[model samples]
Target: MPTEHVLPATGPAKVRTRPVRIGVQIAPQHASYETIRETAAALEDLGVDVLFNWDHFFPLSGAPDGLHFESWTMLAALAEQTARVELGALVNCNSYRNANLQADMARTIDHISAKGGTGRFIFGTGSGWFERDYDEYGYEFGTVGSRLDALAVDMPVIEDRWTHLNPAPTRKIPVLIGGGGEKKTLRIVAQHADIWHSFSDAATLERKLGILAEHARTVGRDVAEIEVSTEIGSRSVAEVEEHHALGATLFTIGITGPDYDVSHVADWLAWRDERNAQGPLAW
Candidate 1:
């Protein structure tokens, strides 16, 4: 029987009030491995805080037959090529690999990143979605609730195995959970995630965050410790402030396709620096 790790009721830490972090998800569905490599290095040179790739077998957009690459393999390579900047999948599917294996893989990459300085590997994951990945990869595609159940079971197993591995991770691997299902998903976020990501608009994000806080209280956890993140399509400085007011300190801007134009990353980097200079806004 799997042991249930009851989360403490203290809630998340007040880290959101710290310096804001800006991240970019390098869409892997439409670029070649070489282009992806160069893009990752360039993003680091441009001073983006974090870089990410998606976990998928085929293209999520564009023509179904368009270029696509595996997530973890590319991440391992990125871990080696880049000297700075954190790296991880924007979200890896929990159902694809065994929990222990996932831990080992993450440990290996953690070592790869720790070569010069501190290791920076954020383990971003979610309950597996996209039926095509399941059918093609030979994994079971169960109901969403079932998948979440599996995630709840596997997360602790991964954490436990990390301790007993031959060489433990140099730094605590931050667990980033992505999704916005109110009941189960938010509950999981309150209980386990160090970071919670959602595709919510500012208004919706504010509303859902309130619910998440309530869930955290119910679970005897601190909501403040969990970093709240959302995707941005536009770079309106005011919109960034609006989300920051809602307690979102980490922001990810996703850029897609054949030409992974990272020109906007410079703008975001500038905005991040400006926000840092201003200090945390009073909400």
Candidate 2:
């Protein structure tokens, strides 16, 4: 059974300009652990700000019964291997583990990276999808809304446990929420997420942001406190500007395979630098 989780509320708002962050989701469902590890190191070397893997039991693409790896174990190894670059799942399934255990695991990984610098572990989470994961793992795969309701209840407990845990995370783990359901999901993002990640083209993203802003206003929080991110399907530099115009500053491109080729990561790094050089927006 999953554990109960909660985050303590604080007063006042801190306004921050969303900075462009580029990340790569190293798809683990189809790659060997060694290949995935090397891919992670390669992505770090290529200057990607964040390195991520999806949490799953079966391959999300290609053969359904292809090579696969466990997410947190790989994350622990990644903490030990990479010298730079933040590490975490693109989003972990909230249904698989107790929230307290998740917090403790994150703390341990944070310590693994603490030798040289503050450990970087972004706690990216979402309610479970893929019925196979539930059936095979003995978890209850309820309705989507029920699962999200569970997540909304559990997030605070996870945050509270982080402080009481013996080691504690080396740094505050940025809470990233994935999904773009305007009514419930985006409202949850507005309430609990430090980062909001979704899949959408520019027009769709623009529409969602407006909905998210309404959710934020309803909750009395500034939507700017949340970093906006989306997955890139094409390598066009113009797409970056299009998403940026819609308030998306963090973009992740996903690569999957037995080979884990990430040559395009370099292009994204260059694009990020170019945008930074252009200075702050006129607004």
Candidate 3:
């Protein structure tokens, strides 16, 4: 990517965020609970800033009927198993469960993790996708437009439920909204997310930032307040620096289960440390 095409500082509105961080999504498909648990421990031990599992009931690749695990139940256990490393679903389907119930569950997991150390839970969510996961799991497979509408409507309810929870959450849980849809998704992100995650390249990221910035203005929120997250799984460290310049701070790598190879992560982690040392706000 050309430096000229690099993202503007702090995005369109010039709002800056904190230091760069690394996250890993340990996909909970095609593996046993024991293997999944071990992978989670290994990731935390590898010093990932966050650990994520997708909220799905079936394998996304390879055999369609491969081994898979339930998300929230597994998350509750991970909350107890790991002493550190902020954890959550990479993106939980908003359509599966009731909005208020989701909030309550997030709060419970928050407390569970807090008992070990600082509350390390991120409420990562997305407008429900994956048709098979819905149909087989008994959810109404609504259209994308309907699901986005539901997301927009339910978020307010979810936020309200958080305030009314009995223990009131260990701290205000950070919400990570994933997707790159311009109209509905970006609007929801600007309105509610603490982190906005997307999988796009340098040029595309810059274009998306412009859209997100516009949405932020419409929602009366600072775009910089939401940390930018991107998947760095396939990109080289050199390729990632371009995204860093383009304003992505939370770089995530995906590890499929059964044979979760994370040897590649060490290179990215080293890159993260070197960038952080340059200065608190350096890209």
Candidate 4:
């Protein structure tokens, strides 16, 4: 593998004029598939821009052995079930499957979700982290560095497989990478991601983005081309606004379990409308 490059930071972060998009990650744990299925439909009907699920074999919270559905398989089902929302795993684990297999699965789901026009699949992926997921599923629970290294190696192969697949993915299938590792993760984001998802607050996001820009410059790409995405879990509107001011356009709220209360979703939708109504070019 080629050594990843890190260059000196230069220039202020570019201002983005993209319209704000709200996303919801319906946690698949502790809920029946029927409940999850219904929640996905409800979110789309409520006008969320994207729907996501985590890629894990078991629940990250609540009971350890709670009812949990697989990410990609449920995503394929959601592809047929929903009409408007773009959907994918919030971040699929690169260690779970072969790179080419991941590409093919994503392509099939892309086609399944297209509804005869364009697909709504966004390939959000990351290096594996959860230890139990690896142990229970018989995958190597390597160190973080090794897992990230594997991801770096797999990405080009995944992208290359897309080119050679029989019926290519619809609309080039936007790639969303989730991580904030300055040297490794951001380098992958700079090289391949159309959107970068991180869990940073405004100040950290601002600083990390400067690092991201340096990586982009090292690879001769514009950092502004990668959309900034952040989680809105329990964040107040004002807090989300802080991130928004720093050019993070895609905000996702996570709702979990049987009830899957969407009371908060309406607030986010309203925020999205308020931002977008200012016009795309509006600061």
Scored by TM-score, the top model is 4
lDDT of 1 by residue, 206-282 (tens): 88888888999999987777888777777478887777767776789887778899888888888889888886454
Cα lDDT computed for each candidate against the true fold? 0.83, 0.82, 0.85, 0.88
Winner on lDDT (3 vs 4): 4
**Reference-based TM-score of each model:** 0.91, 0.91, 0.93, 0.94
Taking all chains together, the TM-score of candidate 3 against the true structure is 0.93
| N/CA/C clash count, model 3 | 0
Between candidates 2 and 4, the lDDT winner: 4
* lDDT tens digits, residue span 1-283, model 4: 1111122234743334578899999899998998998889889999999999999999999999988899999999999998889999989999999999999999999999999989999999999789999999999999999999999999999999999998888878889999899999999999999999999988899899889988999999977678889999878889998888777888999988967999889988998998888864322
In model 3, pairs of residues that clash are none
Question: On a 0 to 100 scale, what is the lDDT of residue 50 in model 1?
Answer: 87
Prediction 1 global C-alpha lDDT? 0.83
For model 4, the stretches where C-alpha displacement exceeds 4 angstroms are 1-15, 281-283
What local lDDT score does residue 75 receive in model 4, on the 0 to 100 scale? 96
Give the lowest summed-lDDT range of ten residues in model 2.
1-10
Best by lDDT: 4
